[model samples]
Target: MSHRPIALEPAAVDVEVRGGIRPADVRHAKETVAALTRLAHEPVLRATVKLVASPHPGERRTAQAVLDVRGRLIHAQATAESTRKAVHLLNDRLRARLLKTTRDWENLRGRELRDGEPGRRHPAPPEEPLPHRPRREDPVIVRRKTYALERAIPDEAVFDMEQSDYDFHLFTEAATGQDSVVYRAGPRSRGDGYRLAQLDPRPGLLGPVRAALTVSPVPAPVLTEQEAVERLEFTGRPFVFYADAATGRGCVLYHRYDGHYGLITPTPA
Candidate 1:
């Protein structure tokens, strides 16, 4: 493959070559790095490209690019049949991620500015703690993972949740500091979107706790069952808990593990 002339501004970008990358491939990558100069200005748009040796002879190279676009990290990687093709794929993926993140960030900023305008006061509804009675039953503890609860807007959380490709994400509401979980409800074709369920830990339970538990009292977002189902599909999770806006009751939407969804709503006592 012919080596393209390097167009990347050396002072603004740093290139790291690793594994068994050939000199010619490294030269191609330097030219490809120039592509990112259009994404951001000099000095502010810094990027690191790591070229790794590909295991298969057909796919001769793997490229990983981590671009620091004004402090926010954007990562993309590609493995292709050729070094140049791999670099091209990496750049394409990186551009898509950067554009999506930029659009989401701008939309969030715009919403914040609008919410700050005067004469718009939407107070949260008053919430009373739900009754909780301790259950005495030995349960199996299979797995446990400690995670730091980050405070972010729902849009940002959704972005992270989608990127993580997890069933659910637990985060704190940036506006209220309320601990919340965003979970997938069902398939996206069914109009299911991500649903946020704020944790409202109920008191008045008396028992010897069998396991360590941390609960935070907070209010959940009120959405109808249909709305909850729509949000559930976005997270790609099996279940979600949401406050039913119609009945003013808490409900759970879960997958039956047989290609179906089960909606559990509070019954009148």
Candidate 2:
């Protein structure tokens, strides 16, 4: 769709071709820059469009766009059979991201405005529950799925996790050959960090996946529990993982909601 005339000059949009992209697709994206800027509800500072081709047949073209609104970078991505379709999908995703960012900004601003008013005080902290209530949804194995796990070290895994834009990532620890996951602890905040966990299968269970998986490969460096804990604190991530020096088994160190560190180890049945 056409948008109101705005500054969508030649330098406003940058289309980077990795493999190759159709000329028509690039033209369409440039033409739609104004519409994207309007959706952002602010003057677009800069825009980057990336096109990459995949080996797969049905879904070959992947499009990614990064919009710089002021100092914030909003990202969108889409994959389709055709480059044109992927670009369109990318535009739609970018619009959605802009809408969400705008809403969140407005909400935060409203909270600040209210909190700054006279005669208003900061809300009290939540009361501690002696025993947590059970969740409404009962435990059920609704589906079973598996992915080939890639091998990586804790640091490398954390880097990959950050780049993937996923809450949690599963990989095989390069040092111990054990399965591990790097995950985020809480809401996005400045200095908010990630946590790492490792799985040591109980006796007779499968261990050390040797298969290549769909994940970034990273180097695994052995870490002591104390080192992991220190890393956790330094990163401000919720948890950390390493081979427990005492147990010789995989272990997880995490931050408990009550402001304490909790450790988990698998015990034999």
Candidate 3:
């Protein structure tokens, strides 16, 4: 129904198979990798898969996958009885990696506004978009959501948010790291203006960097955990709800690209 594979860009898979001197072993290694590569094109979320074999490991082979998205890297390692099993293990590992990648990319949206476009000079590693299928709970809000901001000078911040596909773009003061927000800032009717959110308590360990879906077209606001709650109560403008304290009142409000408002709140009753 919804985009199943969250990854649009495929991660490069590298494998090293080592075992007994058998032709099947070699064939299986190649086949498994070929399968994943082919899946990448279908809907399994694949990019480039490279397989290598050597007699170094002898009896056992290891799977090492360096899953990277927009420079965000996650390493997965698994040992298996055979190269086929190892590839399967790597497949599972990549699924988990994408989950983490999805959440992190969402949060990065807030910081990209002023930080300049992601992958400008060092652009994201060459990868393909993986087919994304949303879970029942992970509903599909929208597809290909797009918005244009006032010429956000030094476009790096905006670029990063685009790369991550965040609901709201958070901007950092050119020299000061002070945070600002840019989303549909005017009345829901006028549908214009991306206001600067008011962050509170600022951010620290166990911080409030999280946001709610109701905050913007795409929910995560760009601000430190401490300042995440600070918002200007402008009449008729989209604003974020927040609570800042150990008393358990804080949230990073935002909207999914689908137009669903969400609240990334703290753990309370």
Clashes of each: 9, 2, 58
Off by over 4 Å in 1: 1-12, 41-45, 55-60, 99-104, 109-149, 160-269
Report every candidate's CA lDDT: 0.53, 0.53, 0.37
Query: What lDDT tens digits, residue by residue, belong to model 1 across residues 111-177?
Result: 4323343211222122111111112132122222334557676555655654433345666657655
| lDDT winner between candidates 1 and 3 | 1
For model 2 the local lDDT of residue 151 reads 68
The lowest-lDDT stretch of 10 consecutive residues in candidate 3 is 126-135
TM-score of each: 0.42, 0.42, 0.27
Model 1 local distance difference test score: 0.53
Best by lDDT: 2
**lDDT tens digits by residue: candidate 2, 132-243:** 1122233222222334566665545544443333345667667766767766544434234554445553212333322112322442235676676577677765555565
The window of 10 residues in a row where model 1 has the poorest summed lDDT is 127-136
